[model samples]
Target: MIRRISAALLALGLATAAFAQAAWTDAEVRKVDAKTGKITLKHGEIKNLDMPPMTMVFTAKDKALLEGVKAGDHVQFAADKDAAGEYVLTAIQQKK
Candidate 1:
């Protein structure tokens, strides 16, 4: 029983690590929502190894980071998967 419990914990740790996201690019920003810290981004095509091509709205962590950016500006951004597994922007920079 102890061995099984250990194995289960190990598996859980691995699963958590797998879900912890590294980073991603937004490609472009379509809209900015400061009130809720959500951004509508026209992102580049993302073909995840475990998923398929898709585009959607993303919530960013720092709404202030979008100060000078506009709907048309291209940005190289990074995101982290939230508790619910939805992508949330964590870092970003304007792409010249």
Candidate 2:
């Protein structure tokens, strides 16, 4: 019974984490630095990274991620820690 309970708990924890990480929150582009593939965003809850709503700068996995985005644009973006140990954008798009 104890083992079963532990397994259930573990599964629940994993599901919650996956759901959090998969969710994308809204943000406003404060700045876009195309040369460096970085952008400043004032974002809502980033549960995947355990970040609260705030303004900060982040690097993108690909420079092209910033190609058509500009300052003051509302966007939805996914961010994750890269192998280099920096949090970078995995995906992004302009909000409609």
Candidate 3:
């Protein structure tokens, strides 16, 4: 019974997280920490973040997310919220 309950709770959590209504804005890469897999950024407009204008450091999932992007380059992407409630770069594009 306990195992079943845990499984149900986990499923519910995953579903709720999958539909999260989060957003992102166009940002430029400031610097990347290869060791930590994090990137410092200068963001233009992150509507959902509601943060003040400044550079910020964020965790990156892998080195591939940094491909085709560089410091001072403009890019657009949205963060993805996983079942564990962690946000990561899920979509990205060079500003056109």
Q: What is the C-alpha RMSD of each candidate to the true structure, in Å?
A: 5.8, 5.8, 6.0
Which digits, one per residue and each the tens of the lDDT, describe model 2 over residues 1-96?
999999999999999998666668799999999998899999999997898999999998999989999999999999989888898988898886
Which residue segments of model 2 deviate by more than 4 Å?
A: 1-21
- Per-residue lDDT over 52-92 for candidate 1, one digit per residue giving the tens place of the 0 to 100 score: 33456778777886677678888877665788888787777
Lowest lDDT 10-residue stretch of candidate 1: 45-54
2-93, model 3: which lDDT tens digit per residue? Answer: 99999999999998786464464778878866566667777765655455556677666666777666778787766545667765666566
Per-residue lDDT of 40 in model 2: 97
Any runs in candidate 3 off by more than 4 Å, and if so which?
1-24, 80-87
Q: Flag the better candidate by lDDT, 2 or 3.
A: 2
Candidate of highest lDDT? 2
Residue 51 C-alpha lDDT in model 2: 88
**Over the full model, what C-alpha lDDT does candidate 1 score relative to the true structure?**
0.71
Displacement of residue 8 (Cα, Å) in model 2 is 26
Count clashing pairs, candidate 2.
Answer: 0
Error of 1 at 91 (Å): 0.9
Tell me the deviation in Å of residue 44 in model 3: 2.4
lDDT score, candidate 2: 0.91
